[model samples]
Target: MKKPVIALLILPFLFFVSSCNRGKAADEVNGNEKKQTKQLDTIVKKTALTIDTVDYNKRMVAMSNNDTTGRWPVKAPYPLPGALLPYNRIIAYYGNLYSTRMGILGELPRNQMIKKLQGEIAKWQVADPTVKTIPALHYIAVTAQGAPGKDNKHRMRMPFKQIDTILSWAKPINALVFLDIQVGHSTVKAEVAELEKYLSLPNVHLGIDPEFSMKNGERPGSKIGHFTAADINDAIDILANIVRKNKLTPKVLVVHRFTQGMVKKYKEIKTVPEVQIVMDMDGFGDKVLKKDSYRSYIYREPVQFTGFKLFYKNDIRKNWVMYTPAELMKFTPKPVYIQYQ
Candidate 1:
């Protein structure tokens, strides 16, 4: 009877050990499952948006507060435009043909200018190896300094012939083109429609400087300019149509703003997958002022992307040094678009 009782006790002990091993196996399986879940959540996936003519509004990817970058603590709510992501960043030089002192774009002829740009791009590549550099030509298609011409449009429009010449320069370097518009007294719809031919091109993009919009009949430089949310939405619609008709990649629409009044009803501006809107802080001052302006205007308002403009001469006033790329990246969501004028 004692032997039988001992045998029963041993059997129970063995069963208990087996049960413990099974529990540990279940825990291991759960750990593997959790790791897979994390990888899926963190990985940046490439998404493609289909072009639709009939249902343009339905296709935009509504984004809000993406996952942390680990590098950038402040993350944008929306997914970045697919074309300019993963690691690549755009560095552009802005200027018009009339002003030689304005920016690198107009400072030199094609060959030497490209050589200089190549050097600058190389420097950025060194500063942030993780971010690839994209070169761009931000040619001012309309100048705000001119008189209101035949149509009472104070802005000077660069002729298509000359604009084509600028576009050709991009081909040699495989750069992108931004035809910046300063409407002066003209409407955004009229201005954007004028550039339909160029905007239709794959490499050509659009930039609207509300500083020169002069919504109140004031000359562009006489007072600050403004672009209503409705005006910006109109521009977006034009770009969307161009993208759909051409079956091209996503187009970027840059709106220039430095003050609170430069853009109104900004919250009402709508975006589509076909169009990526950049709210650029076009004003330049000391590094501190620049950061404050960005924080006040851009960071406070959620947008699809952000752009920072650096005025080569103006930024150095009062012995203020422009913010370097490393420092600029410190903003909550780093600016993907960097423009130098």
Candidate 2:
């Protein structure tokens, strides 16, 4: 009886000790989690501060044309002011694998496409030897055609396999990849979110074409679409988050525009250190009309950066030669981004 009494007395002590130990372990884990969370918060705050340091107020002032000759300086401060742009200049081939008429990006066999890209890079190097030219494969990951899919999204998201395959195709040649989104009837925010995983990669960038955004329920290709500055901001904000989390170089955002209606509220599109916005003039015409379009639209607007597009079939329709590297250099601030499609 005495032995049983002693055992019973010891049981409570053992239970108390076990409970104390379990509590200690739980406390340790919670403490560690809090510490990590605090550290990440600090890092994110620092990133936001870095963006705030860039005086957007001075952006317009800096892009001013102090030069009277109307000549775009070859060494102009470009891509963005007060920010480190990834490349001295970017020249990309745009298209999708399914369409030959779209552009040179995916018209040929995989091996042949890589070879042609290499050739174009070599030629651009000869054309503008002063600036570093980056070769990019602009994959139309999503196509917005006239018909709405069964989902009725009015947009078709490229299968992950296709995007991955093209990204793989760019690897052997060491070219950067750009995933362009037409959005069809979808919203830019939703479309960009779907691509967040790929956009987080260091080598991949993004392009949003307001031309097919279809802000309304109107069918794509029936009328030109529009993207407000708010829409652009949403995309930029998403990219900025990826940059901060991954600690990456600034991501480039190519905004395709040739008409005022395509991109509304231009001034409201703000910039952050983690992303660069390039307002590309995407129009096909003769050299004279193209120049006028560039001057009247892109050059006149003064966005964070400027881009020019050349059409193999359309640019040469009326003129003997497309605007060469030297001729494009004549704008007040030269276009640092050029696309051939």
Each candidate structure's TM-score, on Cα atoms with residue i matched to residue i, is 0.76, 0.76
Residues 1-341, model 2: lDDT tens digits: 01223444554655554555554678775665566556555554434434222343243333333545443221222222224343357788899887898888767787777777677667767765756777788888888978888978788887889889878887887777889999988888989999999999888999999999887789998989889999999999999899889878778899999887888888788877678888899998877777888877777666577888988778887544688776776655667678888
> lDDT of each prediction vs. the true structure?
0.75, 0.75
Root-mean-square deviation per candidate: 14.3, 14.0
Cα miss at 282, model 2 (Å)? Answer: 0.5
CA shift of 246, model 1, Å: 1.0
TM-score of decoy 1: 0.76
Worst 10 residues of 1 by lDDT: 56-65
For candidate 2, the 10 contiguous residues with the lowest summed lDDT are: 73-82
